[model samples]
Target: MLFRLALAMGRTLQELRATLTYAEFQEWCLYYQIEPWGEDRADLRAGIVASTIANYAGKLRAEGSDPALPADFMPYLERPEPADPSDDRHLTDDELAAWADAAIFGIPPE
Candidate 1:
């Protein structure tokens, strides 16, 4: 997946790895219609849902009708705040373990 992303972005894998933060990588994945491996399922699902709605809106506009989507209808279009890498606070071992279990086992972590 990383190789494909690198090719699509016209960047070498080393450069992509060196330059992109995780969030930026995800944004690029979405732009290139490539799914990021190991992305949270809920986030992927939300993207799918939003894409569907946007497509439907496009169809309606093509038919000479206004869908009148709300200003905030597509929240995914907004850029999220960049993560602060220098912050010392981070997820605990237990929280990381729980997230891994949730991703692998399809169970929500408590």
Candidate 2:
């Protein structure tokens, strides 16, 4: 749901990149009541942050600057797999977003 919400927010993938600090993002997630909070959630945020850092690093490299990812960040380079579109049970974007919003804000879709 976070993935879908982020994608819906903007065009560039960088926009979805975890720009906030882990602590800040975690707080936001908690406020939204994102589920399964613990190391798994922490790891998700970390991956987002690391991916953003890597994106910038790549851009910098292209611009003739040297950048390197730390060992911890390296492991997170591979992103989590998106849901398979062929799955019969997967909700459409509108449905998913509506559900997510209702879950987070207690406001159902019109």
| TM-scores of all candidate predictions against the true structure | 0.28, 0.27
Task: List per-candidate RMSD values in Å.
Answer: 14.3, 15.9
TM-score of 1: 0.28
lDDT of each: 0.63, 0.59
Scored by lDDT, model 2 comes in at: 0.59
lDDT of 1 by residue, 53-101 (tens): 8867677566765553433243443343768989788899999998776
Off by over 4 Å in 2: 1-34, 61-110
Kindly list the per-residue Cα lDDT of model 2 for residues 6-100, writing each as its tens digit: 54455344565546456765665675474544434566677668867886768846676545434345443334366787877967899989877
For model 1, which pairs clash?
none
lDDT of 2 at 1: 36
